[model samples]
Target: MNRVILIGHLARDPEMRYTPNGTAVTTFTLAVNRPKTKEGVEQQPDWINCVVWQKTAENCANFLRKGSKALVEGRIQTRSFDDKEGNKRYVTEVVGENVHFLSPKNQGNLFDEPFSPRPPVNINDDDLPF
Candidate 1:
């Protein structure tokens, strides 16, 4: 199966564009953290290239920004093309079938009220199932 699932923060703002046929496409780089090395040194995050299409592309472009967290479900696709230098280049990227916005609702809002803790709920000891 050519399936891939990634959860990461966007390294930069999503770039949206349209194909000649007017199909929407969005591209972004995801910075996914890698596990520490055996020596316990933190490794640099892996930068993954991702692509989304259609309405999902539009939504990703609208809601996701640099540093926004997201979950992308897709498949790994690799393609080759001739570059301007006349050299063939190969690129591998995730073609997102679904992109879920994982950032807080008011994450990038500047005018939103400061967050306040909710009042603690009072429950009787009898409510415990344990």
Candidate 2:
């Protein structure tokens, strides 16, 4: 079983795209920080690539933005392909099965709206522009 669960901050807004068959897909990099290192210096953030499909992808693209914190559950997959320079490249990505919105900014907003499965009408994709 290949499984992965990550809780991290978005390094950038999710890049949303559609498959040839009109399946929605979104990709984003997460910056995961290590708690503490033996050296006591901050360890470099780990950049994990994650992809979500269908409604999950749409939700991610609609709500997620750079610096947003989220929890993702998925499986790890590594694929090898040739680069433009003809060099073999091994790319590792998480095929996300679940994405949970954990944005801090949304907490205790002026309206005091509670978190919902779907964001409010006012918080639709157009408002986010992510």
Candidate 3:
């Protein structure tokens, strides 16, 4: 019941860092456009903060970039900490369980070649049952 799924473009490139214990973590902001309720109404974009850990965090940092589209499935987490000013600051972010890269493999800057469409395979007449 705490699950959340979001498909959106990266607001910026993912930032990777290591914890004090040397655990890898990555953070990124996703910009999802909301649906318009009426004709002529413009959709607003929601900026969601997302986090990934370990190998997933490394992959996200390596493959994803600004404007890259992805589907993130995760759970919401909120935590609070005291700032240097002694004020309590709270943050809410999605802790990603899985992130599906939605952009074409070739379209990513990580890849060298551009995407080329493959020709359709011809079906044999004997293969059809109907």
Candidate No. with top lDDT? 3
The estimated TM-scores of all candidates read 0.80, 0.76, 0.81
For model 3, give the 10-residue run with minimal summed lDDT: 109-118
lDDT of 1 at 102: 80
> Global lDDT for candidate 1?
0.91
Against the unseen true structure, what C-alpha lDDT does each candidate score? 0.91, 0.87, 0.92
Which stretches of model 3 miss by more than 4 angstroms? 109-130
Report how far residue 97 has shifted in candidate 1, in Å: 0.4
- lDDT for model 2, on a 0 to 1 scale? 0.87
Deviation of model 2 at 113, angstroms: 7.6
**Residue 99, model 2, lDDT:** 89
| Higher-scoring candidate on lDDT, 1 or 2 | 1
Q: In model 3, which residue pairs have backbone atoms overlapping below 3 Å?
A: none
- Give lDDT tens digits, candidate 1, residues 1-130: 9999999999999999999999999999999999999999999999999999999999888888999989899999999999999999999999999987887768762233347665789999999997
TM-score of 2: 0.76
Residues forming the 10-long window of minimal summed lDDT in candidate 2: 104-113
Measured over all alpha carbons after superposition, the RMSD of each candidate to the real structure, in angstroms, is 9.1, 8.3, 7.9
